[model samples]
Target: MLELNFIRANKSRVIQGLKIKNFSEEDLQIVEEILSLDDTRKEVQTELDSLLAERNQLSKTIGDLMKAGKRAEAESQRERVGQLKEQAAKLEDSLKDTKVQLEELLLKVPNIPHESVPPGATPEDNEVYKAWASPLPELSSDALPHWELAQKYNIFDLELGVKLTGSGFPVYRGKGAKLERALISFFLDEATRAGFEEVIPPLMVNEDTARATGQLPDKEGQMYYVERDNLYLIPTAEVPVTNIYRDVILDAADFPVKMTAYTPCFRREAGSYGAHVRGLNRVHQFDKVEIVVLQHPDKSYETLQEMLAHVSGLLDKLELPYRILRLCGGDMSFTSALTFDFEVFSAAQKRWLEVSSVSNFETYQSNRMKLRFRDGKATRLAHTLNGSALALARVVAALLENNQTPEGIVIPKVLRDYTGFELLN
Candidate 1:
C-alpha cells in the first residue's frame, strides 16, 4: 500500500501512473473517491476530538458546580455531556467506516511504476533488458516436446497424476523425479553460497500473512483456501519468506538481510486451459527455490541487480538460452515497483518460457507489512525484494526439449554431479 499522504499529495501523478497501467475509468474513479473519503474521515476525527475536549471541560465544570452546591445546574451540564458522548460515539463509528472504505480503495490501486518503467499496457511492450550472446541450439526435425520426451524416457507420468490427483498435477518418476530433486538441491546450495540463509517456511499462512504480503484482497481467488481454518495455501515461498520480517523494526546494522527457501507452491490457476496449459507448461503445483531480501531503502535497487545476476548465473550454468525483460507498467505485479522476468528459450516448443522474476517492491510491501528500519533516531520503511532462483517445471521443460537427442535427453553439465548421471533415459 502507498503511504496515504503520498497518494493524497500526488493525485495527478498517481492518476497518470494508473493510466499507464491501463486502469479502467471505473478504477480511476476509486482514486478520487479515496481522497474524498479521507477528507471526510479527517473532518469526523476533528469533530470527535472537539467533542471529547468539551466533555472533559464539562466534567471539570460539573465537579466545580457540585462543590458550589449548584445541583440543578450540574445536573443540566451532565445532560449536555451525555449528548456529546453519544455524538462522539457516532462520529467514531463513521471514522472507522471511512477508514475501511479508504483502505479497500487503496488496495485496488497498483504500485506506482518507477520513473524508468516504460509506458505500456501489455507484455509485448516490455523491453528486453538482456539476452544470451551465444547462438541458440538448433534441434532436429524429430525433436519432441517435453511431454513426448517424458513418455519416451519413462521420466514422468501425467495419467498417473490424473488418477492420483487431477489434471495440472503431473507425477515425476525415475529420472524425472531425480532431476527435480537435484535441481532443488542445486538451487539451495547456490543461494547459500551467495550468503543467503536457507529456510523451510510453512506451506500455509494465515489471512494476516497473506494480506501483509499483498496477496489477499486481490489475488485471493488464485490461492487454495483452507476455509475451516482460515488459512491460505501459499502461492510462492516469497509470501512466507518475506513475511519473516513483517512488523519488525531493525537497526541500521541490519541493512541487508537475505534468505532463500525451496517450497512446493500451490495455485488454483482459475480460468486457465487449452494448449498453453498442456504438459509442464503450466501446472497447479510446482517446486521452486526463491530468494528474498530486505534492504535499506537506498540500497534496494543495488540488491535487486545482485539478485538478477544470481538468477542469470544459474541459467548460464544450466546452459539454457534465456533473455530478461524489464516489465512494462501493466505487466508488473501489484506490489512491485519494478520487475524483471527471465525467459528461457524452449527450442522445440519455439517459445520463451518464463523461469524467474526478480522484483523490488521499494516499500510498497514493507508499508503493508509494517517492516521498518531505525537509523540512529530516525526510522523508515525498508525495501523488500524477491525472485524465483528458478521455477523447476518450466526449466525442466526447456532442458528436456532443447537438449533431446536420438539416444536420450542430456542433462546440463552443471547438474551432472547433482543428478549423478549425464543423461535421463
Candidate 2:
C-alpha cells in the first residue's frame, strides 16, 4: 500500500503515474475518493481528540468540585463530561469508518512506476533489455510441440490428471517426474549457493499473508481458496516466504535478507483458455522455486541487478536461448515498481515462454506487511523483491521443445548429475 502522506503530498505525480499504468477513469476516481475520505478522517479524528480532551478536563474539574463538597456543581460537570464522551464515541466510530473506506480505496491503487519505467499501455510496448546473441533455433516441421513430445515420450499424463482432479492439473510420470524434481533441486541449490537461506513454507496461507504480499484483493479470483479452512492455496512461494517478515523489525545491519523456497503453486487460472495454454505452457498447479529479498531502500536496485544476473546465469548454464524484457508501466504488476521478465525461446513452439519475473516492489509490499528496519533512531519500510528462480512448467516446455530430436529429448549437461540420465526418451 502507498503511504497516505506520500499520496497526499504528491497527488498530481501519483495521478500521472496511474495514468501511465493505464488506470481507467473509475480507477482514478478511487484515488480521489481515498483523498476525500482521508480528509474526513482527519476532521473526525481532530474533533474526537478535542472532545476527549474536554471530557478529561471536565472529569478533573468534577473531582475538584466533589472534594470541595459542591455536589450540585460536580453533578453538572459530570453531565457535561458524559455528553462529551458520547460525542467522542460517535466521532471515533466515524473516524474508524472513514479510515476503513480510505484503506480499501488505497488497496485499489497500484504502486507507482519507478521513474525509469517506460510509459506504455501493453506488453507490445515493453522494451527488450537484452537478447542472447546466439541465433534462435530453427526446427523442421517434423519437430513436435512439447505436448506432442510429452505423449510420444510417455512423460506427463494430462488425461490421468483430469481423472484424478480436473483439467489444467497434470501428472508427471517416470522421467517427467524425475525431470521436475531435478529442476526443483537445481533451482534450490543455485539459490542456496547465491547466499539465500532455503525455506519450506506452508502451501496454504491465511488472508493476512496473502494480502501482505499483494496477492489478495487483486488476485482473489486467481487463487484457490479453501472455504472450509478459510485459507488460500498459495499461488507462489513468494507469498509465504516474504510474509515471514511481516510485522518484523530488523536492524540496519540486516541490510539484505535473502531467502528462497520451492513449493507446488496452485492457481485457479479462471477463464483462461486458448491454444497457447496447452500442455506445460499454462497450468492450474505447478512447481516453482522463488527467491525473495528484504533490502535497504537505497541498495534494492543494485540487489535487483544482482538477482537478474543470478537468473541469467542459470539460463546460460542450461544453454537455452532467452531474452530479457523491461516491462512497461501498463505491463507491470500491481505490486511491482519495476519488473524484468525472462522468456526462453521454445524452438518447436516457435514462441517465447516467460519463465521468470524479477521485480523490486520498493516499499509497496513492506508497507502493507509492516516490515520495517530501524535506521539508527528512525524506522522505515524495507524494500521487498521476489523472482521465480524459474517456474518449472514453462521451463520444462522450453527445454523439451528446444532439445527435442527425432530420436530422443536431450537433457542439459548441467542437470545430468541430478537427473542421472542424459535423455528423457
Candidate 3:
C-alpha cells in the first residue's frame, strides 16, 4: 500500500513506475482521482472540526448569558448553535464518504519498485545475475524422468499417496525418505552458518498473518484453509516468520535480523496444468528452507543480494546446474517491487524448475505488519526480504535427474556425508 501523501506528491513519477510494472495508464488515472478525493476529505474534516469547536464555544457563551438573564444574547447564540449542528452533521457525512473513497483507492495501489529493479515486461525481461560452472548433464535415450526414476528406485509412491490423500502428495520411502531429511538438515545448517536464527513456527496462521504477508486479499484461493480453526495453511515460511514482528517496535540494534525455518508449505495450486505440473514440478505439500531478514530501508536491496549469495552458495555446493532470472513487471508478485527466481536444470525431466524466489519487498510487508524501529528520532517501517535457501522436492528431483549416470545416480559430494549413500542403486 502507498501513502496518500506520497501519491499526491509524486503522482507522475509513481505512474511511470507503475507503467514499468505493466500497469495500465487508465488504472493510474483512477489513482490520481483518488488522490483528489483525499484532498477533499482532509479539507472537509478541517472544516467540520472547526465548526464543532465554534459551536462548543457558542454553547458555553449562551449558558453564561442565560445565567446573567441576558435573553437577547442567549437567544442569538442558541440560534447559531442550531444552524451549526445541521452544518456539522452534513459535513461529517461528506468527510466520511471522502475518507472511504480514499481508503478504497489506497489499498488498490501496489508497492513501488526499488531503484535496482530492472525495467522489463515479462520473465524474458529478467537479467541473469549468475550461473554455476557445472554443465548440463547428459543421459541415455531410455533415461527415465524423475517420476519414472522414483518408481524404478521405489523411492516415491505417488499413487499410494493419492489414494491415501490426493494427487500431488507423493510419499518417500527408505533412502528417499532419508534423503529428504538430509536435504532439510543441510539447508538449515547452511542458513544457520549465514547468521540466520532457526525457528519452528506453526503450519497454520491467522488471517492477520496472511494479510500482513500480502497473501490474504489476493491469495485466498491459493492457500489451504482450516475452516474450523479459521486459519490458513502458510503458502511459505515467509508468511509466519515475517509476521513474528507484527505490530512490534524494535531497537535499531536488531538491524539485519536474519531468520530461517524448515516448513512443509501447503499450496492449493489450483488451475495448474500441462507439462509444467508434470513430475516434481508442482505439488500440494513441499518442504522448503526459507531465509528472511528485516533490514534498514536503505540496505534492504543489499540484504536481498546477500540472501541471493546464500542461495547461490547452496546451489554450488549441491553442484546443481541452475540459472537466475529477474522477474519482469508482469510476473512480479503483488507485494514485491522486484523478484529473482532460481531455476535448477532437471536433467531427467529435461526442464528448468523454479527452485527459489528471492525478493526485496522493501517496506511493503513491514508497513502492513506495523513493524518499525526508532532510528535517530525517526520511526519508520523496516524493509523486508526473503528467499528460499532451498526447496527440497524440486532440487531432489533435479539431483536425481541430473546426477543419473550409467553406473547409478551419483549423489553430490556435499550431501554424501549426510545421506550415507553415494548412489540410489
Backbone collisions counted per model = 0, 0, 0
Best by lDDT: 2
Task: Please write out the lDDT profile of model 1 over residues 274-391, one tens digit for every residue.
Answer: 8877789999899999999999988999999999999999999999999999999988998888999999999988889999999999988999999999977887899999999989
lDDT of each: 0.92, 0.92, 0.86
Candidate 3: regions farther than 4 A off: 51-97, 132-134
Q: Mind sharing the TM-score for model 1?
A: 0.94
Pairs that collide in candidate 3 are none
Task: Give the per-residue Cα lDDT of candidate 2 at 411.
Answer: 98
Total clashes in model 1, counting residue pairs 3 or more apart in sequence or in different chains: 0
TM-score of each: 0.94, 0.95, 0.89
**Of 2 and 3, the candidate ranking higher by TM-score:** 2
Candidate 2 residues 13-69, lDDT tens each? 899889889987777887778888888888888888888888888888888988999
lDDT at position 160, candidate 2: 90
Estimate candidate 3's RMSD in Å. Answer: 3.2
